[model samples]
Target: MEAGGKMMGMQLSWIRNPQVSAMLLLAAAILGLVIANTGLGPGLDALKHAHLPFTVFGLDLSAAHWVTDGLLVVFFFVVAVELRYEFTQGDLNSVSKAAVPTIAALGGVALPAIIYFNVAGADGAQGWPIPTATDIAFALGVLALFGRRLPTTVRALLLALAVIDDLIGIFFIAVFFTESVSLPHLGLAAVGIVAFWMLGRIYRGKRGSWPLRIALLAVALITWWLVAMSGIHATIAGVLLGLVLSPAPAESARERLEPFTNGIVLPLFAFTSASVIIPQVPLSELSPVFWAIVIALPVGKLFGVTIAGLVGQAALRVPKPDRMKLSELIGIALLAGIGFTVALLMNELAHRSAEDLIVEGTLGVLAGSLISAVLGAVYIALLSRRYPAVDSTERTARDSEEYLRRTDSE
Candidate 1:
């Protein structure tokens, strides 16, 4: 019974409800905007500015510090969890499965930064991560628009690219966005890191079930708090917790958790973070920063990923991508340029130093994410008729299930 429980939990952890996730994400963002702009913004701003008690057993500070330095740790933990899972059992674990997308993700990340930096420059260039993320919700939502016409390969490629892009975005956050370090806390972080790994081993050795994961949540929260205080970005905590307890190892555990993470947790996070006020920044007087973001994110992302994917195939003799047209492929690449959640987080983190610049970056993300979604949708809808991606794996899984049933009947 214990073993069965474990397996069931694992299955639950890995469901991919992309449609629901995308819609909820968009709704959340829209809701956030509505709330923030409709008189709630002032309250939020006041709350953010309001000084709350930050008593840490002995050391005390303000509330905003806690939010920035503390609460956001949960977000970071999720990011770590996703990163580690991908590196271990997810799309990134297999080279062949990961190759094309990784290459595309790399190009997508590099060129946008280059373009953003050149046009926007290093002064405000710290905001580059804003334009880096490929909001999976937005991209996938666009794919749904094409429905039956879209190639399966294009969808697969887009997802892979987004994951790899997410990985890169994390590294950027860790390296670039961080503030002056505290060496003592950093060392302590190393100690806590070892402890987390040890915990993972213990749970795996026990062949942990859902209860075990639930039990570990308290520890993970504690671990995240410790690391957040230790000067590391707190959001890394979320990713770590996810990866550590990732039921993906056990098929059943993946079933329950994947759906929640994809359909609920991820969407909630997107909505919470994306609700920025589109305050009247007059279009007639838009900044060059805006135009740079406009050109750099969409144009740069499409050209960069498309060209890199082509070059990789041509130079390395990589296998030709199956069932996706050059046009549809490029379209998918464009959609992958939509940057939102990560950008907003970064903007909030970096705003003190570069407020004006961050606004432009934010605008760029909105424009790029929106444009990529629309254009990619139209382009794929037109070409999807010719290149329908036959999902061989899906077919094989169904076939195997049918064969097993027949064997059982016999």
Candidate 2:
């Protein structure tokens, strides 16, 4: 009974977390900015450039690179695994349910790119991808503060929107962010994925076997290396490897993985990948890159997602959350604009040629993320009214089913 009570308390807190997680996320993000901006300026820089014993075949890597490439690989793997799970059994399972968020994601992707290109692309539109990021964990963490105030349907809707956003972000990274494609190597990557898939089929019986899962993990890492060497962002390898290394849908292996993703992978990723040192601000002159990122992330994402949601609703009557009015919708959309992780990647890839742009872009991510969190938190807190928790549990079950369907699907 004690254990059961604790579980219920956690779930209810998660369902209506009184904004604890959300506040934590915001605090962490803001703390990152403070660390970067404060007097430890030189220390942070040294840490980023610090030499690590991260040697592989005598290959040299810095602490920052290790975080971005090595540790963050686990992050992307978690995301890809969830994506696969969703397709098999969760929210993306049915066409009716999937269509609305998918289209919303598309609109969200398109508008940000267009806005960023037009605004920051002064040098022939180079930093176009900077705005196409939606930092889901940060936003959802903040939403946790509202607890029972948010309807389960709305929560599910927000999650679906973010996942779809991630899919689109992955595609854009593959196509636009690559410097040049090495076809021969790319071919090898394709072969590696296919070969692994075949191996997975042979290993199907080992879905729940710990030893087998361990072996496959090593193979997936090797495959990831090959894909990264092939000039494709190594992140795609994480996604593709997930598709091949997935457990059979009927099994319950995913729930086992869920805790790690939520508790460890995301938090670790946030901690490691989020250590941006705030550049010296000329508070007087925020660069165009800064303004572009500021506008593109929050304004563009909100504009794209909210309008897309409205349209999807009008066209297909995508069901809205019960017991909450339309005001909650805007809050959800605002949170969608908090593009931290993905935006950081785009800042790395798109702004590579101009380090200054990367610095400015970081500022935009910080500002936009803060505004979105504050506004979303406030909106939910103000509007949270009496409502039943049935919908929250219902969505949880549905999400699980959708996840099951995804990993099992062909």
Candidate 3:
């Protein structure tokens, strides 16, 4: 029994590890792609396209939709909680702390979009949002795997930047992708979201109160359903609830839900999204949407982030000790291109009407993200050689001491 318990604990630890989770996500995508090109492709495609038998609050969706719309909402909730934490108590708590990264993030968004529009043309305008995302898990995974010698400041900057980039992607989904909004359903969802916020605040200190937790969960589901029926993306509901929930309970929810998201929700979505048959055409014959994403993601992100970060630093006249060097900023910018998860989702939403574009866009996202991951890994590894390794435990201790010292002085 003890041995079994230990194994279970190890499994949970692995699920919670960002590096391991990112590797698993990549593996799942590769597996799906491989299987999709094989003889078993039909079966896998059938499974993904198969609609579930029942409808919940008028949501009758396919297996793939269930992952994207349902399970992925939980992932967004965790993201939103982390975002709120950053804005309140973490790296983005103040203007001075947030300005450079926020500017860099905006650059990351704008350049890729401009490149996509230029490449794909006006008819392909809807697909411009595809390359604007930065997958937080994949970006963090690459950093954790290869950035051990890198300063904590770099990690914090990357985290803040990715969070902000996702916020933009969420905005695109809410504003651009939403077609027709049902005011009645949206009004109800707003009320439910408010109630959710109130419940979280009331139960903020009551960690053991299962009854209230269950009630919160019920309200959350109802809000999600209402948002879905209201013609807005259901994931917006998660974002709303996460933003409004009291900090104490929000943090608690993030911790508890991380494993479920990392271990199951993400990998499943990756597999389903990446399960597209590769287009059998020559590169020249491929749609411009494919080439646009492939180019915009890595190249645009690299230049966009580096330029914006340097400009922000220069304009602010940041001190030498506090500002990152150009080389280090470039490395982080490379990682900003790793927009696998959200990029795939955006590709689906953008090209859903055109079957051919959807397949091409999927390939584009996978290929683009893979290129970013490889480039980021190689650059960061070489970069790590310039800096001596720092133990995370020791760093944590030093940070704690510094915090206490600052608090005493204040």
Candidate 4:
């Protein structure tokens, strides 16, 4: 039992490592691209599109759909838990702390969409959401590479902005992308959500409640199914169920599930989503949808976040201590453009009907994200030189002394 516990601990620690997860995702995308361009392309393509019919659920989904709609739910569930914590207890718990990031996130969303709309014209307008996402894992992994001496405020700002960006992305998925909503199925999903909430109350802190765990799983699955039938994106079910669960149990679930999500679900999704045939056409012949996302993600995010964050900081009179310098905000903005996972998902959803446009958009996301990654790294490395690293031992001792001082006063 002890050995098994140790193995589980190691697995959990691995999942928590942002740099490793980012590298795995990057590796998966590269593998997919290589496989798709090789003689094995046809076999991989067949595997991706092959459908397994399920009459009971009235579903006949492709293998790729199973990865996107079913397995990706685990990723969204973890995101929802993080969102809940941020709103309730973390940096976003107050208006003062949340103001700049919220405004910056909105600017990040709006400007990219506007840029895409103008660049792509009316026919390609649906792809506006493609550049609006920020893959927190990728962005933070890049930050970790050069931010060892950066101020704590820079990381905090990035985290807040990313969380808000995710919230906006989820809203776009639920509102703008949903096809047709079935009231009856949505109602059923609500019922499942309520039941899950009730069970969460009963099961809170009951670490060994296997029966409760089983019941919660059943409810979650039912909710996902109902949402899928309702013509809503099925991943929203994961978000709703995650938000309704009690915090302790929800966190426990996230920790337990993170390994599978990081190791299997995300990498698989990345591979499947990226396994597209490269267009045989020249650069001039590529669709406007491709060029739009390519330009919008990095340029749009940099301008949008920097301008909006600066304006919001000025307008709100954010304290000097809390306010980020212009360079720091710009660095974070560039980092925000590393929209690999969520941007790719949005690309698939937005251009699902246009096969050529889908391929173009995928390539666009990869290229744009790569550019952002390189530029962000350079900017962060330069910025890091301006700040010296804090001594870990001294910082910890200082924090402990402060805490004791406060305790004595209290």
Which one wins on lDDT?
3
lDDT of 2 by residue, 34-130 (tens): 6766787568768877885666644356676666666666657667766776776677878887887777777777887788777765663666766
The global C-alpha lDDT for each of the candidates, from Candidate 1 onward, is 0.62, 0.66, 0.88, 0.86
lDDT of 1 by residue, 27-60 (tens): 7667755776777887754664466465554334
**Candidate order, TM-score descending:** 3, 4, 2, 1
> In what order do the candidates fall by lDDT, top score first?
3, 4, 2, 1
Better of 1 and 4 by lDDT: 4
Which consecutive 10 residues in model 3 have the weakest lDDT in total? 401-410
Flag regions of model 2 displaced more than 4 Å.
1-28, 52-55, 207-210, 249-274, 277-279, 317-325, 386-410
Give lDDT tens digits, candidate 3, residues 1-410: 32353344445655766798899899999999999999999999999889868877678988999899899999999999889878877899999988999999999999999999999887678999999999999999998899888887888889999999999999999999888999999999999999999999888556547788899999999999999999988888889989998876676666567888998899999999999999788999988899999999999899999999999998888898899889899989999999999899889888888988989999999988889999999999999889987888996577556433322221
Error of 4 at 134 (Å): 0.6
lDDT (10s digit) by residue, model 4, range 279-383: 889999998998999999999999999999999999999888767899999999999998888899888888888888889999999989999999999999998
- In terms of lDDT, model 4 sits at 0.86
Better of 1 and 2 by TM-score: 2
Question: Which residue segments of model 3 deviate by more than 4 Å?
Answer: 1-11, 392-410
Question: Any idea what lDDT model 2 has?
Answer: 0.66
What is the number of backbone collisions in each predicted candidate, taken in the order shown? Answer: 41, 20, 0, 0
TM-score of each: 0.79, 0.82, 0.93, 0.93
